[model samples]
Target: MQLVEDDKYGWSAKPSSCEKGHAPKEISVDFDEVYKSIILPAINLINGTNLGIKIDCTRGEDLLDGGNIVSQFLQKICQAEITITDVTGFNSNVIFEYGIRLSVRDSLNILLCHEGVKLPLDFAEQRFKTYHMGLGGGNDAKDYIVETIRHALPLLLAEKSVESVENLFRRTVENATGRTQERRLMEVFEPAPDLLVRLLNALNTICSEANAPGDKKVFRLDPKLRDETWKLLEEIGKTMENSSNLSRAIELYELLTKLEGFREKRRDVFYNLNKLCSANPDFKEKAQFFLERGIELED
Candidate 1:
């Protein structure tokens, strides 16, 4: 299959002679300027000589047959070899499509977002790659994203088996008895203390490098590592809250609110801080500040 330009849709696949017998490998994407200029170019670079692979993005206008749009979307999500979702701005339709892909497929569902865009609470724990649209004339951002996808694609394709969220829930319900169910749920949310410690160390190292002088300064991290760190921090804050260590939880969340790349739009952090601060008499004013900030970010 080869990528063919269209007058209406931005890109689609045209089957080549070699792909006549076998089904073409497909990568489904949520189309936007970022995907058109950055993501697609990166994929093309890494997809060299792999003409059987096709990139697909469905536009609303493409559903001209009077078929239900939702049905068509669901079919695309289920059929694609991989789905790359752009979750920026927390668009409800995109989030719904992403959820469908996650529930049905265990792996090869990648989320991409703009740097500093706050995701919804339910999806804050999900791993996503972020790209900077304005950093270093955009080339650095594109290069970083390209390298990330290049490294990830091979590993994702090599996986022999994977577990979907639906399957996990089904398994849990099948095997869990009342108390065990609670414990299982807790286990899913809470990472081991050792893992938390390691994540903390990694964050510290990144920060230190970022702060280092001149040529050594690391402005941003690998997108995967950055997502992992954000998730870890959020989890640690929640763990502290569960243990009744509200002060520590507040501290952790506050730290997130001060961290670069996160401080601007981390609504979850501000929301948690607002809740935690409201519980303490001394922080009433701070609580209101956080609440207002969170509302601003939400808007």
Candidate 2:
């Protein structure tokens, strides 16, 4: 929707002194080029990360201005979790607005400029990315920014959950030790089994017991929790095997076989799946395929 001058943050009067002349200097509303070059591409990269990532950004000029809007505008700028500033063309307004953002936040900001543009001297100590446009360059600097942001987004999202200063510092130090440390933790951390896994486990038990023809049903004595979990899986598999419910057995085995995190036990999963395949003709080909896949992975 187009912004109107009557809004809470928009100005209805003439341009403020800071916005006119060399200040609010006429901006090149090359929005299509801007979206094509940077914003849309960065967004797609972030969304593609598969980390349940969400990100959106808008240019400040696209929104309304005026009224007590200056304060509202500066407040919104201050509240922004991350701010990206480009000093392309040495635009005075861009520089001034960036200064305002830094006044509210020091870190969580990135600066960029088109190649060959003059960077201001006062911000000399800070690092900024230089983007190249047009033919000679095989790569754009915005790609570097996008890549860096994509890499950093997960770590930043992980940090958002930290509730205490000490724990946050510890995570920061771990991060300082290596960039991959946070990712490693994410990879190895065990997620709680979803409802489907739990439901399937119960169904496996019921179907297994239902298979016996002659004898009165008797639920066998199972040991209470052991400190070792894999042994428990083995025991459970053996108990369920007595009833010969091949479909349930195959489903359970398939879960283990498909998981990337399963290390040595995956081979055992394939063996059990192939063994059960004999009892169910429907599963035989699928079992053979996965068994071959497992073998290929090993070799």
Candidate 3:
């Protein structure tokens, strides 16, 4: 992604930073210079990348709001597909930050375009799916997904060359399943306490519904399924409120957690159980048992 910042007001080119006093005049000049030079080039460069553009107009300050002009320029570049994310703040050079993002995006686009290799639409969709839903929230997930795509795309395309879509689908399904499993495990270790009960109920309804069979066989309920499902339900049972539906949440959480394979999250089971036990009086004894077992494992 590459980012370019144009401060038409020339608010940036002045020496006002040295003088302890604010000079509206210097700020005005800097704004003008930026408006003339910076905005046009950025608009011209938008067509090459898929990530699209994010324009920030906060730097224009008091003189002239550069948003309308910049936006018109962007429209000229790519009429529909170009994404314009605008942000406003009192910061002197808002464009610079956006410029950096554009730069990195430009580099990726250059690679994809230069490779002259058009990935099938399905490949693109799969990559996006992994990015938006499966990737980590903070940093690890984003880095991992990008790096994985960089490494995996070439192999996936090359291997599927001249092959049927079914072949590609089979190969891709494994990776997707693995991703789903990893996400499931994360849920077990770090259950979204606020949404877990609701989400679990939803899962159970889907699993047990008449439509859950055949096409919905994605969960693959079998011997392994039953065991994992039971464990998840047991976990939920240990923490559930008296008013909560025991069957639905327990069944759903168990099935979903088991299917996703939370190997890394196994240890967290007791930690969460302790919290659950603390929340409900009935589970105090069960929680203590798990808590003691967890401590022993740590020791």
Candidate 4:
């Protein structure tokens, strides 16, 4: 197979006789040499080994057979198992196709770019591999490409879907709205401290039962619910501490130590607990316990 330059589309593979009757893995690139030097060699390394799959590297133009180019290109972008787009030059068509792929799939979409090229703001947060196209840089670029694909293959094979750029934005928005709603609900329950305490206890019980050894059908909690509950407890605990309600703050912080969620924050909880308990002469033993636990966590 040879990569040939087209006046209309930058570069596309001229399918050889041996390249027929296999699945096509599309790579969208702006430069002809990028396909020949970097992409082709990396793809050869991947296909040469027994990785349980073969990649027939092609571009959108290669799939054209006397049909509407746009329609065929969109179809390939949507259906391909892996879509690699080289955004070195930030080509408009390449970016557009990549956007379409991001909207449809949650994984196996890769972006490659020349080193030091800043991507658009929308794609800035998205993970991409960069390589230098200078002298003696081709080998480095090829190796990086192979490594990127190698890391991605496990997730693909395990059928674990990654978060797409579109989904990430949606999740961000949803989480913000949920937080606002939670704050409003807390405000309504703040006047009735007993009700708030009962609600916190109920959330803790749900978190405990979810992890307890028993029938899966009998007790289960949504992971989001568990996370939100922990966040609420932490927020309320800090609020009580700031308000000098040390007894209530200590109670909440102690509850956090018993819960499974937010293990990373436990050391900070212990530190706060120790500080609170140290103030009262009656809580010297509890203060020592918290201090020892906090010191242990540092190791």
TM-score of each candidate?
0.37, 0.40, 0.20, 0.42
- Tens digits of per-residue lDDT, candidate 3, 105-135, equal 2211111110122334633332221111112
lDDT of candidates 1 onward, in order: 0.51, 0.45, 0.34, 0.56
Please write out the lDDT profile of model 2 over residues 1-299, one tens digit for every residue. 00112111111111122332121234322323444566456655655666554555555554443323343344445444556665555566556667665654443566655555555586656787755545533146557656766666544544321112222222332444563422232222212122222332333454456565667564421222111233434444454443334444455445544433344456666665555554456667876876786686574
The full ranking of all candidates by TM-score, starting with the best, is 4, 2, 1, 3
Over the full model, what C-alpha lDDT does candidate 3 score relative to the true structure? 0.34
Against the true structure, candidate 4 reaches a TM-score of: 0.42
Report how far residue 289 has shifted in candidate 4, in Å: 92
The best candidate by lDDT is: 4
- Please identify model 2 stretches exceeding 4 Å from their true place: 1-32, 64-67, 136-138, 158-299
What clash pairs does model 1 have?
Answer: none
Q: What are the per-residue Cα lDDT tens digits for candidate 1 across 1-299?
A: 11232111111212111222111233222335565566566556656646334444543334443323444344445444445566665656566666665676644556666666666687778876666555343354457655654565555445433223323333333333443332333343354432332334456567667666677653543455446656765565544434334554555556645656565447877886777677677678888998998898885
Model 1 ranges off by over 4 Å: 1-31, 49-66, 135-299
Worst-scoring 10-residue span by lDDT in model 3: 106-115
Candidate 4 overall lDDT versus native: 0.56
lDDT winner between candidates 1 and 2: 1
lDDT of 3 at 285: 80
